[model samples]
Target: MFFMFIYYFLFSWNLAGVFGVDSVKSVSVTEGESVRLNSDLTEIQRDDEMTWKFNNIMIAKLKDSKSRFYEDNAEGRFRDRLKLNDQTGSLIITNTSTTDSGEYTVIGTSTDSTLNIFRLTVYANLSVPVISRDCSSSSSSSNCSLLCSAVNVGDVTLSWYKGNSLLSSISESNISISLSLPLEVEYQDKNSYSCVINNPIRNQITHLNITQLCHMCPDCFHCGSTEAVIRLALSVLVGVAAVAVMVYDIRSRSFQQKREQTSPSNNE
Candidate 1:
């Protein structure tokens, strides 16, 4: 009897595949959006009947040429959110949430068995990542420690990148809360770095410029020490050289005038 039951199950499975219901359709949408699962049927004849299920739990049924929700199916997460079309057996879900992501199947009972399957993936919208510098280090080295964070998100990954090269990444699963990631880089590094927050559907990035931040730190860029001394020395040397040249020119001119006055001129 067990062998017979196995054979029956295999035959039923194969029969389901023969009806073109084996291929799974993929659908992706953002959270709080609406999605429609197409039945691939343009019209349902008067004698046709259809049924829709989510994970094999019937949510909609068509009988006696009338479309309606199955008894006790319009409750919980699906309450007031499911719309069914009687003519085509298509199902539309409104204000979709991440919990609504699942496999939906529509079965048609007519002259030929029809099966349509859809795997729906709903993603939360990515939030803008906030980047902040951590200046708590006691060392004199001006290395910048940056923290990137986002809140109230789910199924996301936070990453740090130097240009196109990925440095670090953190991923969260099924969580809708706050998280953060950090990166430390040298003060003089001119490469472009960015913090990215992403989900399956969207991503947001914030760019960082370490050189700009280092301009204010004396220890990092040597802001006011070396360069300022060099500038001051150059200015003093330039001023002294100008004064000496002026004094030498004046003395030479005065001596020449006196010699010309004392010497007998050819015309005199």
Candidate 2:
């Protein structure tokens, strides 16, 4: 073990990475997706701290001070949206769109050497994930299920969030339905349950799902089918138009023959 350690120390990729690209090679980011970056900042020296530059402009300084998070020069548009997670060397931008997309670089320096430079592309999304009412099946009898949640969320409570607002309590430890607890009101709004999850260190989000017993096989709880009705109406209108055109053509031809006969043009 000791010889292997010595061999690794003398001729290992660790030493080689100090001169080459130790981080991301190339990454593709969708218009509003994430690009994960995992790296170590400890190799940086005190005087040789890294600086994040966007399009040739300095945005932030790395690990210089507790309060001195990221270079303070982040572009005006990205003020509150650019999240620099120091723990994981992760960079996150929310609500990605096309204009926010660009080339970003991390320039790290050592005692006297520039270790490596990593580059990434960023994108923006104007719209967030819509909390549509999904009525999928779940193991719980409450077909009132929510799904398509964000993956890799750390330890966080699940609850409802509406348009950047917390709609309910994070902890659902003792939620109970009681007989005296306004059963009428509950019946009126019993169809939807919002699923929320959040952690203190990171952002929280809520996705909505829907109503009870959507599966009772049509025992009179009929969810309206707007599309089917529209199609039916359209079909009837087309049929009426066809009949009207046929009648109009026949009447016009008959009227023309009668007029010719009366004018003596058809007598010969």
Candidate 3:
């Protein structure tokens, strides 16, 4: 079982890496908010220059010995909107919009042909969600599941909550806007749960309350009722037996007393 778990983990991780980067990376912004993306060079010498490319065009250039590339390119719908800090090799795109959705590739030259690559993804706002669930109302209490669903959402997550308190959560995938949470449901007392569906793709929430309305009580009607009746009958029977025994003892004692007082042999 443990080995199977390990293999499952590795396989899932591999699958995530393979299918994870499917969506255009999203960044949330107000009307004029700035965001940052850091591109690091791994196994590369410090004397290398890093370059940020948007749509195959050089957007910003980094000086050698500086890890950052600053843009500050606020031209053509980006007037004072783009800021690229070349020293840290990070990009700060300001005043972002939906049209800003495109390929952003950062390339760092290594000694070998191994170019350290960083993809800068950008996204904004949220999408209307199409959602679903995995665990049903009839599911057992041991392992319950609920899935919130959507489309075209990259890097989203699903959080299960009972009221304000978080019950459980599951990470979202690239292809799917769905969130799956495997949880232990309380058999009786729990109810009215919701799944907050959110990630870099969109922000929305879905809910699954325990639809089966239950009055909180252990049922004592049938079996307990029978037991009470049986106990009452047994108590009545014991009372009658005790009364008969007491009456017999009293009658015997009285008869003995009468015989002693009226002493026929002694009188004769």
Write down the lDDT of every candidate, Cα atoms only. Answer: 0.78, 0.45, 0.55
| Superposition error at 101 for model 3 (Å) | 2.8
Between prediction 1 and prediction 3, the one with superior lDDT is: 1
* Candidate 2 deviation (Cα RMSD): 18.4
Off by over 4 Å in 3: 1-33, 41-49, 63-78, 108-115, 127-190, 193-202, 206-268
Model 3 residue 81 CA deviation (Å) reads 2.6
- Per residue, candidate 2 scores C-alpha lDDT tens digits across 165-245 of 545543322224111100011222433444444443233343343333223324322222345446668999999999999
Best by TM-score: 1
Residue ranges of candidate 1 with Cα displaced over 4 Å: 1-19, 63-66, 70-74, 111-114, 137-140, 174-177, 209-268
Ranking by TM-score: 1, 3, 2
List TM-scores for all candidates, in order: 0.65, 0.32, 0.33
Best by lDDT: 1
lDDT of 2 at 65: 28
What is the model-wide C-alpha lDDT for candidate 2? 0.45
Q: How much does candidate 1 score in TM-score? A: 0.65
- Model 2 misplacement above 4 A: 1-24, 40-48, 64-75, 109-116, 122-268
Better of 2 and 3 by lDDT: 3
- Candidate 1, residues 33-114, lDDT tens digits: the string is 9999989889878878888888878888776668677646534678778888777778999999878889998887664454
TM-score of 2: 0.32
